[model samples]
Target: MQQKPLTGRLILADVARGLALLTMAIYHFSWDLSWFGVVDWDVSGSPGWRLFAQLIAGSFLFLVGFSLVLAHKSGIRWESFWRREIKVAVAALAVSVATYFIFQDQWVRFGILHSIVVSSLLALPFLRVHYVFALLCGAGVILLYHWLGDYVLPYRQFFWLGLNSLPEVSVDYVPLIPWFGPVLLGIGCGDILHRYDLLRLLRGSASPSVISRCFAWFGRHSLATYLLHQPILFGVVWAGVTAGVLSTNAGDVQVRSFQQSCVMACSQTVDAGVCEQACRCTSSEMMNRGVWEDLLTRPNDADVREIAQQVFQVCLRR
Candidate 1:
């Protein structure tokens, strides 16, 4: 069988990657805003937001699988493959090290880049196998992880496998089980596209629009962009806060946090109206007593526990 030399680039793949990159940037920026207290809503904890994040991550993984198949379809491009892997491995290490300094408690131990490098290697053997087999394996792994959750693993090291419970503070964690599913699926998709000569079709009809070109450029240099975007955003936000351009009203932030937490806990037991009233009472008392600053800044469980006892008694009596 004659193999096609990698002469043409796939616009569709690049565009898809560009879209994922944009989505990730938007999500991360919003998360940064929430962290700075500019946004009262919890981007991380909300169900819809969480799903959006997962979809973005899954899309990127799928693209990784797709790119791998397209690159190695003719034969194993060992030199290029190793070069890309090394680049990704180094980037992953950089992320791990950088995040350790920024967020010492919840550093990215095995983030998206780490998962991709590992999964790429794992998926290599499956490239030569049938696409349907790859698809099935992907599905099975996803399902297996879902089932694995019912059982507990003893070791903390096994957390990267996605079977163990996640750590208390994980900013970005992409485990092997379900995350590998998208990569395998991408491989299958790549195989199907290759078999059908869809790459040629896509390349031939590729758009020459300015927007398309810009996105493609972003896709091409996604690694560099990914590495730099967060630092840039952090600097901008930090600078704004320092310059007093961004609002850092500690009282307002603390009040919202207190209300959100109080209402959430109270609503589980009482009515929404009751919860609202209780939260309002607690908020006012905390603010009046000058304990709000301490709770907001240097909150310990003991302090919270004592405050909760006082608030519960005071609010319940009213």
Candidate 2:
């Protein structure tokens, strides 16, 4: 029996974030459907869907910037800042661990939460400076990504920086370079909003509609919702598959799934170059020897297992 007027902590910013969350849930649901073979096209891979995802990621990062400024513009709130930072960092670690089990190879190495936490830490220096400086710095970083994209990195370890080209195997990779631009821009926008009293004006005039209230509620509890939504969606899809309500061809699904998972998992232990080659070689060799079915059906078969291992070893050497 918890009841409080929604208007008490309500703000336009919360509703805006809520809307972003709603869209994000929808995007993930669609992606989950594709993963389950409910759809023919890969929602996460399609150009339109990819663009949609970028927009969602951008919006979330922008809000991260905006929220950072809103909380600390008066002066740095060291206590509150660290408290929030710890929560975000912990949630990010949780995501990495969970995804490691669920998606192993393609687990979220440095996904959105990881990026946000790092970006927030990096943005601390700019908080006390002029907004224009942050805006320009952000713009410069974005351009730097484009400029650096043309050069080959001498070392592969720094791929997480997002300045180098790497195999597109990560399930959710949001490198720091271009992505941090939005956050910096958001900080600048926050300054503009505060200086003009925009946030106060928006909050003062907000209508207490049910939709608005619900959105605000979701926005307020965004972190918890973000953590839970994916697992729930995944469970629902798994249930459907178990109930035979949704049918997927085992071979196509399993092969693609295994290859993708293998590359993603392998990438963690090896460079992207080696992982990609090994996975491609392994999957191809399995398919070529007409032993893919045997491997899938009898994973413990000594002969097939030996052949798979040999392929991996050869791939690594090459």
Candidate 3:
């Protein structure tokens, strides 16, 4: 038999979300530092950093699924659901628009919020299904993507399906296939919690520490924190750069890093000699034209982007 809907908010979930938010902030700070050349390592490309990012994304998606069950286990609250969905959808659109203007080359078209909007809708039917069935479906989705994720569909619009051979240039690209698996798994877990009345016990438990309480607060306002934290962190780093507290050699470091990454990426499709020559050509040209620093700091600036594109074309012909 099905159990009644669990009453009240789950404190543990909020604390978990708060902790996730904290870790996310830490990761973003590292990314910001790297972007400003304060760090030598590439936070976006490092294996450890990539793994951390994936785990954080998975936790948030899982919570999305779990929260769905918590809110609608008794019955679908259509009004509340629509209200929240519209808000999330709007926020996702705003992110896409904002990133497009800021990072024209690698904007976020389908990031975490976008994924949540789609995955939440897809996960709705699973809420009424058996927990074991939901788990099975989740495993199947993950396995399917693992086995066939490399096959490319021949369209740019299909990139968000996770089945296309698109460049991994987007700031955030959370596709529906494997990512949706986490949501299904979260739903299964939530179902089990309700079945055993575990949520009620968790809700009654007191937060043991002030830190935990703080995390809970952040968790309760996770969306706002997610949206606002990056701009604030970026501003802080930008201010440090303006004040001359950060490294002045950032341009040199950035150029070197770009050459290394470009060669690595180019080598995958061409000979080492060709990759090295092209990257060196592009790097030298940008440096010669005095656009390297501007390109890094103001990637979206029209004049910088135009000059950068011309440099790339010139290098490609060499």
Every model's TM-score:
0.81, 0.79, 0.81
C-alpha root-mean-square deviation, candidate 1: 5.9
- Angstrom error of the Cα, residue 84, model 3: value is 0.9
Candidate 3 Cα errors over 4 Å, as ranges: 256-318
Cα RMSD for candidates in order: 5.9, 6.2, 5.9
- Per-residue lDDT tens digits for candidate 1, residues 54-74, read 999999999999999888977
Off-target runs (Cα >4 Å) in candidate 2 are 1-10, 150-152, 204-206, 258-318
Q: How far is candidate 2 from the true structure (C-alpha RMSD, Å)?
A: 6.2
> Could you give candidate 2's per-residue lDDT for residues 1-318 as a string of tens digits?
212212344377888889999999999987777788776655644569889999999999999998888777777889999998999999999999988898766678889999999999999887887889989988898888887763456445866677554544667889888899999999999877776655565474446789888888889899998999888988898899899998866655676676676666676556665676677678887788788888888888899889888877887787
Worst 10 residues of 3 by lDDT: 267-276
Error (Å) of candidate 3 at residue 182 is: 0.5
* Model 2: colliding residue pairs: 105-264, 105-265
Candidate 3 has which clashing residue pairs, if any? Answer: none
lDDT of each: 0.79, 0.79, 0.82
Clash numbers, per candidate: 0, 2, 0
Write the residue-wise lDDT of candidate 3 on 1-318 in tens digits: 667666667788899899989899999998888877887765765679989999999999989999998889889999999998998998899999999998675689889999999999989999899999998998888898988846556455876667765444567889987899989999999999988877786674564578877888899998888999999999998899889888646564677567666765765455444565787788889888887878788978998878876886678678
lDDT accuracy of residue 259 in candidate 3: 69
